[model samples]
Target: MTKGLPMRRNTILLAIGVCAVFGAIGLFALHMSSTSVRASGLMPYQDARAIELGKTLYEEYCASCHSTNLEGEPNWRDRDDDGYLPAPPHDPSGHTWHHPDQQLFMITKYGTEKMVGDGYKSRMIGFKDSLSDTEILSALAYIKSTWPPGIIARHNKINGN
Candidate 1:
């Protein structure tokens, strides 16, 4: 009975280890499977049709978080002590216009994960899984369409175009 008892304990330990290893592997796989788009060469959309599609996508996905008029949440610049803003306006009033198109694309596709890094979680969800590259471009076009001509020119300059 004593010998059998040792064998049973060893078996249980092995089973636990196996389970732990599998659990870790599963977590790694899950992380890898996440659909986060990496930055790619810009796709030019110098047409009205592309702009319209982009507008539609923005209305469907971004309008809720960014607000209908692109006015983000109120008092967005004033971050609390914990460093979370109340979702600032995406309009010219906010700093969204300040960022280049590539940065904006990354933020939208990879979300705050790429923007903040580490465990700096944000409510921003990556659109990589939901939106294709073309759709993302369209959405971006839509956002850019919202900006004034001056803001758009500034952004183009920042992008080195």
Candidate 2:
């Protein structure tokens, strides 16, 4: 009976290993399908030169509070006893990547107030009164270009085109 115990234990281990492998394979398959299609709908100025122009615009118009590298401010995730984040990072570590392009564009154009309802307020100034639509789109293009391939792929999937 003791000898048979060893065989039973081996069988249990094998089952667990097979389950783990199948779970891993399923996850990978989902990820692959999610990124299969790239976004086709895009801003007009999406070329390399536009991305460069966007970088300059970001530095000039967005750098003060958002930071030069879009890193935002110190303690960006922490509230100043007022329940507001200092300024979130534009990098992948922050929520910037999670938003779809249209939402980001709207936020830039109309400020957070238009999107988040009347009561909400943010330091972000609306570019609608100052920047043209083309310029705004270019700025977004530049930011997207900075993201890693995987992040971009995921964003494309989220856009569903």
Candidate 3:
């Protein structure tokens, strides 16, 4: 009976530990979601610190594929042999501005594969684990800050602002 009692106690402890792990994960996820994609959208573009941080992140994580000047790949509209589209420019000339702020956030955080859904392969891996939610927002804001005033206006309209 004592052996059975010990075994039951161990099982109870294990269950508590598992519950704690899941609870912590749930809290973290909630925090992440709250910090990202605010209802008003795109908070970092004009902020000096965010722009600077975004520039650093862009050069480090994005420049290799998107170009140092945000020019993207040569013939970016075309697909590679592996059937993935080359990275597109984030500048005014690019279609990046065509998408709304929330979409841009989702694509950056979740990557093209998950954003586009099933049967799709994407070279863009999600930055959710790699970059903080704040970093992701800053990067997007930096991209928008590069656009011309008229383009920015159009984008704002698309975002329903």
**Candidate 3 per-residue C-alpha lDDT over 48-114 given as tens digits, one digit per residue, 9 for 90 to 100:** 8998999999988889989989999887765589977688888887778877676677677877766
Predicted candidate 2 versus true structure: per-residue lDDT over 74-136, tens digit per residue? 977444676454776787876676665665666677676444543554566679898887788
RMSD of 3: 16.9
Worst 10 residues of 2 by lDDT: 30-39
lDDT of 1 by residue, 62-86 (tens): 8887877878777564445675645
The TM-score, computed over Cα atoms with residue i paired to residue i, of candidate 2 is 0.69
Question: How far is 29's C-alpha from truth in model 3 (Å)?
Answer: 17
TM-score between model 1 and native: 0.67
Q: What is candidate 3's CA lDDT for residue 107? A: 72
Candidate 3 Cα deviation (angstroms), residue 54: 0.5
Q: Candidates' lDDT values, in order?
A: 0.65, 0.67, 0.75
Candidate ranking under lDDT, highest first, comes to 3, 2, 1
TM-scores of the models, in the order given: 0.67, 0.69, 0.76
| Stretches of model 2 off by over 4 angstroms after superposition | 1-40, 43-46, 81-83
The best-first sequence of candidates by TM-score reads: 3, 2, 1
